[model samples]
Target: MPLWLMILLGTIFGGLIFFAIFMFVRSRKKSKEALGASAGETSKYAGQAPPEPEVLAGQVAAIREHDAAFDEGRFLKWAEETFFKVQESWTERQASGARALMTDACFADHERRIGELLAKNEKNELDALAVSGTAIMGIESDKQTDTITVRFNAQCADYTVNAETGEVVRGNKAVGAWVEDWVFMRARPDYLAGGGEMPAGGLETNWRLARIDEVMG
Candidate 1:
């Protein structure tokens, strides 16, 4: 082979080897940096504290201790049933059926509202009422009364009709979602001295709905 040709071939091979080495080193450095960043991120997340779940659990435990016979499941079922029944009674313009399930003030308010509707010759009608979800949001008690507030998410077909003409006056027939907070109250008797028992037939003898407020948003 000619010396010039041999020298040219050697230079080309050396340059190729150097380029490969440079690329390999650059990639290795980048991999290390990426791995380090991932590790740092993991460590940072691990070091942060998470919110405690015990707060709500502790509150529930305290409420349980306050009333031994207070069954959460039973109360929730009763609340849901009462909610639907009250709505039905309201639409029917009769508070007598639900009066036993509510406080005096609450019943009076309901009666006044029904009276207004009657005077206006209008009636609110609800169909396909269903409780989608229910939860006890709060519990409080004093020397005389114990109140348990519950959140109810429900959907129904709500509309108003003119009583005289039997025609739709307001609201749509489409199903609409609504949220409400209902407060049920019971007299604080000698619960610690063995006193809390819901009447055999129903909660009408023990629990009375204090008030109801709609939840927005």
Candidate 2:
């Protein structure tokens, strides 16, 4: 999912939510780049150190201060759903469907790739997809924003085809798997917990997909 995961990591959005444009483009050689995308574009945070478990615990605790309702289980579900929808959009080379879930920068990245596919009348096809597991790697925040990184592990048959004749163009239709680190960001809410009542906001909104980094094996 090079241009994305369009999957763009929107391949999933730039990298399945990246069946990622990079996956196929990251294709590394698989179909449409598949979820098993290539390592084409590297995320800026790829090589940085991850927060230790203890630190991450503190980070989650801090997030709870901002969002008392933050739940890892529910967050992962959102991540999973985002992955599926972005992948679906990637297949169609349409990035808008996932616009609501991504930051403008992230959305732009996926959009650029989808546009390329449309210009060429090509489509990335990802199928037989299954997520084995998803987990958080890190969580942090600036004075005005919150950020979190999550890892997605999944498999699928990936390939690209000529939109008109359905001819195999660049990738193979073989099934394969991939791992990606998706970063999400959002503006800080107007209020923070002062040990008082928390906002009613759920884990949705207030956060948007920021970036996706392919985990190089």
lDDT of 1 by residue, 79-149 (tens): 88888788878878886878888777777777777787789998877768788898777667755567777
What ranges in model 1 sit over 4 Å off? 1-56, 191-205
Local distance difference test scores for all models:
0.65, 0.68
Model 2, backbone clash pairs (residues 3+ apart or across chains), number: 63
Best by the TM-score measure: 2
How far off is residue 103 in model 2, in Å?
Answer: 0.9
Measured with C-alpha atoms, the lDDT of residue 31 in candidate 1 is 25
Each prediction's TM-score versus the true structure: 0.66, 0.72
Off by over 4 Å in 2: 1-55, 191-205
Candidate 2 lDDT by residue in tens digits, 46-149: 66555577887787899998678888778879888888887777787767787887776667767887887889898877768788888788888765667788
